[model samples]
Target: MTAGLPEPAGFPDCPVCAYVLTGTARLCSDCAGRTLQPVVDPHCPVCSQAVAPGGQCGNRLCTLPLQQRGFSRVDAVAVYSGALKDKIHKLKYEGRRGWAMIFGRLLVGWMESHPERMRGVDYVVGNPTHPTRQPIQHIEAIMDAAYTEDVTHVLPLSPPGAHRLVKTTETPRSANKNLDDKRTAAAEHAAALTWTGDTSDIRDATILLVDDVLTSGSQLQHVARRLRASGAADVRGLVLARVPWSG
Candidate 1:
């Protein structure tokens, strides 16, 4: 639980089934045998839409102009609902920092299984936390503990970089808002963001941007566009959860 103490490689037992887990095991090695599922089911690789099986939509919603600009692909480990949402809420606000280790392990496992999606990644960066928000050092610690030999965490963003992505002139707490309201607020906030970093470092770099969840994806899109503008060769997103659009 301390910052420097090593996080456990995996959860001690299956949170759902109470089955004992072995070292580094993700699922309950004995019970129902349901492995963690990736969010790749008939979803659009660009926008994460749950398209009909074998169906592809080449329309603007599916093939937004941003997709063609710089970001090449997007992938997620789980849907942003039910157990996943509970876990995220716990990690982000409820002091259950241990959950981050499990999430990080899941991310590493997914990347290993789908190496193609990880192509061109030069650095791993989590979304910057706002100045008014709690420091994400614990999340970074969890990532450090769970990081495989493949991925590397880069420098933490300063207050300026974090604030640069703020869009709405008014800073609002969104914990209680509905999805549509959150999306609207985020989009409005993103439009107000202005880059101030020396983007030269990201130029020609393939950056793997990590976030806890993907809701409307407006936030991710806004940040990815800025990265591209700064000369990043490619920007790919790895979110722990994806909230389905319920419209």
Candidate 2:
């Protein structure tokens, strides 16, 4: 099938595993079978995590940090574990940028499956990475693949040189951190964020913020808040993965 614009003549390899593809298949059968574990039913409507029988949605508590973020809702494609997590690590660390194609396909498929998620969303934006941080912005690649053909959701994928949002200072990693530590990191990240574009489009618009994963949600919290402050009427999240609540 046709790939991202300028619409490649053909896609010859499985993006996830780099296996040679024979037909229009975007991913190898092996990789397809093992990955893309979508979040399913009996889940929280707010956070989309699985809800135990007769127990409340774990996120029902008002004190949860995500509740206070600018976004009103979050929809994720899968739980961040197993094969999916491994592939994300490879994409982010090993420079396997091609895997973004599979992620884009997954995000597109998720949007199709849940049509309501796109309702009234004016733009779909990937979380911008700092220019000095990496050789390629992985999130932008995924967004390009997912919405390239559909301009309704697509915005020009921000290159390193021109990002609407810039991370002014590097913050501590959030992995496995305590709640207080995560908050500290989020504060630092938020404080360092800068806006670099015309706010005319953002005014009274509803935005769908896309990201690879949601851990402590420090990244999304700050980005969404900035967007809201720029006059985004509503900001929602569409993430590829969510770490299952460890509590």
Candidate 3:
């Protein structure tokens, strides 16, 4: 039995430390502060991909100029490492669905703190996962939880629905792919993506794409392209974590 079990007043204990939560808190402030590493500076303004101090964007496959890429701007809450990584791992592999809401609430607070990133968003769309490939769609869950927790209505964003952008087919594992291979896989993955929601309202809407983590960022780029083709005026990205720049 866990020490924090039988939680008081039905509020969940902090997932990271089992500390009793007060107010509407999810992970305690201490845990959040300790685990969430800020994105390293000198990142690409367009995709939020980390870059060397004096070097260019780490994404080698991104040939298009900043203004021409799928998303106008992309931001992430933290670097994907330390305890936060473990939390994400549990959420994805251990069926810890409750963490989705916690992560969502955290995102709400993050968006609140960084107003510019979400300035004129119309819809918050989750990067979708194929049903046949995974039993649970992690990104969709995160967005749904975020929608439910945004009580203040700070950002003019609403989650359209889960799997709004569907992954029609499975693709190769990104980790196994080299830079050239990642680019190839990303292109194929983009071709496999399809939007499943109504397009009329989003014709010129400024949409925000939400995802769990930013790896190669090809997925978000693909989704953004699909949305752009569908007539979205501007598409932005907000991810929970980003892989730190190696250079």
Candidate 4:
């Protein structure tokens, strides 16, 4: 005969660790920390790529003059390595939506550390996923990041929301394409988010846009153009990770 089952919340095994989680927390901080990779290196202001301590913004793909890009600046919370990468993959494909909170909190902490970034920001907006892609994990990650940072002013741009920006006809796998191809593809299938509803109130407002990762940054650029054209005074991008170009 088999023994009785364990009591409620008794000897709960950590998902990342086989050991029991005896503490009040669900996943022990020790095991959780293993997945986190703090962005210790100085990064490029344009692309969020880690550079030398006294480095210049030399990534030609990302370091184009601010006047030419969609958003003025972009920042990432962590390097796309270790635990962060695995979690993002699982969240996108495996529906591990719970990882949103973790990525969100990390983004909040990253913003807090760099107060200069959030200065005069009015609304926090998320990059919208297509209507067909039901569970928008990146969308939630942006919202969670804003909420964790106690950011009250946010724009809802996800599915089930009436007004949205940039409805992607197809899911463009950015990593699969070259720089020129990414830029071309981004421009080809672009219908900027048009708001029939009143957005007159935010005409002069400064917006902070958030996303999960920056691969080619073609998406960010595409959206920023729409926002700027919509009369947004300024738009900036923040992401959880900056995917270095594999090519």
State the lDDT of candidate 1 residue by residue for 212-236, as single tens digits. 7766566676677767877878888
lDDT of each: 0.56, 0.65, 0.69, 0.60
Error of 3 at 223 (Å): 1.7
Index of the highest-TM-score prediction: 3
Q: How do the residues 1-247 of candidate 2 rate in per-residue lDDT, one tens digit apiece?
A: 2246233222223442223322222233223434456676787766677777665765532235543567777888788877778878778877687677667766765665566778888766777665556656677667666654233543334433444556667667666788778777766766776656776888998888888987646667767787888888898888888878765
**Most lDDT-accurate candidate:** 3
TM-scores, all models, native as reference: 0.67, 0.75, 0.79, 0.71
**Model 4 worst lDDT window (10 residues):** 5-14
All candidates: CA RMSD (Å): 7.0, 5.7, 5.1, 7.2
Residue 184 local lDDT, model 4: 68
Q: Model 3 over residues 29-76: C-alpha lDDT tens digits?
A: 223544468777787876677777887885743667544568777788
Off by over 4 Å in 3: 1-13, 16-31, 50-55, 61-63, 66-68, 154-163, 168-173
Kindly provide the TM-score of model 2 when superposed on the true structure, using C-alpha atoms: 0.75
Model 4 C-alpha lDDT per residue in residues 87-174, reported as the tens digit of each score: 7877777777665555554555555556678888766667766656645546654465446434442323232343334354665645
Residue 228 miss distance in model 3 (angstroms): 1.2
Query: After aligning candidate 1 to the native by TM-score, how far in Å is the CA of 170 from where it should be?
Result: 11
In candidate 2 the C-alpha lDDT for residue 74 amounts to: 81
Question: Residue 225, candidate 2: how far off, in angstroms?
Answer: 2.2
